[model samples]
Target: MAEGRSIAERLSGAMERRDEAPNIALAEEIGASGDKAAVGELVELVRIGTARQRNDAMKVLYEIGARNPDLIGGYCPVFLEALGSRTNRQVWGAMQVLDSVAELRADEIAAELPRIIEAADRGSVIAKDRCTSLLTKLARSGYAEKAVPILVERLKTAAPNQFPTYAEQTASVVRPAEKPGLIETIRKRLETITQRAKRERMEKLLRKLNG
Candidate 1:
């Protein structure tokens, strides 16, 4: 970062670096400094920069969001639009940012559930993971009536390796009326989970939920 270079100019995209350390460091710096101006530049790069640059920009945006979601809450629409991006990195990165701010922007996010669900259904594992996190946040933030059923459906078909964690997260916000369905879902999936540790986790969750 040159003394006089703009924050955008100091990003990994402008520097043309291949590694992510610089981008991560820049994200940390911008997050710590609470530089709202850099967010606009990063969002622009995410929208129009080359693939590498877009990835770096998205990374920085989400990193900043992770530290203080309120700073990036207003950009929920940008993240939602990125769900339609053909780039897998951008799609998942957008999902990650959305997850970070989902609680703060729950109502806005709840309204975009269709697009969010569509992206998660076809996107990368990371995208799916973040989507689960996003939905969980929405459920916890008082949209459980709308988010939990969808979350339960996702849990039913979630990748076996990822099911336990998703189930655990969903459990936290499950309403009493939804618990039976969740218990049934977990019980049915338990047989297919070959890992003993994961099975025990699901079983424990079942026990906790049942009680």
Candidate 2:
């Protein structure tokens, strides 16, 4: 009460109150501030704060990365760890950031492809979607031939829920030399994808691939 401010006011810096922090506008302001330490602060918010805080912090991180990846790129490991978080927000949030910075650190990130594959199997659908995009990015980064077999295996064994998704994403990275094998893998899995909608999607993909 030194200055007669309310408790919420005095404690705002700690952002303990859910209503007090992770405000999108505030996050945007911090992102636009051009402060070099902003990434550190955002990382703290994501790691220690609530779900809303984590989501907003990542939004700002990607927004900053959009302008200059170097500002948010070096924290790739942090984002990769975030993938293991229980919250869907953090998982997909990390994916967005990783996707943004992957080009700059492909070799380092590509090394974690196994973890990435596990996340695709267990994380939220959007998380898996982002994972597929990252995998495709990795494939394009000179690992196409190696990644093709792993992705094909994923497609063959994917649960019905994720069959279409993995199929769709795998199709995008099937290089000309790899298309025949991927097509064969997809065909073998067609009977397993008994769900009509998903089965149709796979069929459409095969048609597109001329398989």
| TM-score leader | 1
Provide TM-scores for the models.
0.95, 0.71
For model 1, how does the per-residue alpha-carbon lDDT over 79-171 read when each residue is reduced to its tens digit? 999999998998999999999999898899999999999999899999999999999899989999999998888898999989999999999
Minimum summed lDDT over a 10-residue window in model 2 is located at 1-10
* Candidate 1 residue spans exceeding 4 A from truth: none
Best by lDDT: 1
Model 2 gets an lDDT of 0.72
What does candidate 1 score on TM? 0.95
What digit string (tens of lDDT, one per residue) describes model 2 on residues 1-211?
Answer: 2245332222334455455343444434444665566568777777786666566677667666666676777788888888888877777778877877777878888898887777667877777667767777788888787676677776666667877777788888888887888888888888777788888888999999994
Error of 1 at 44 (Å): 1.3
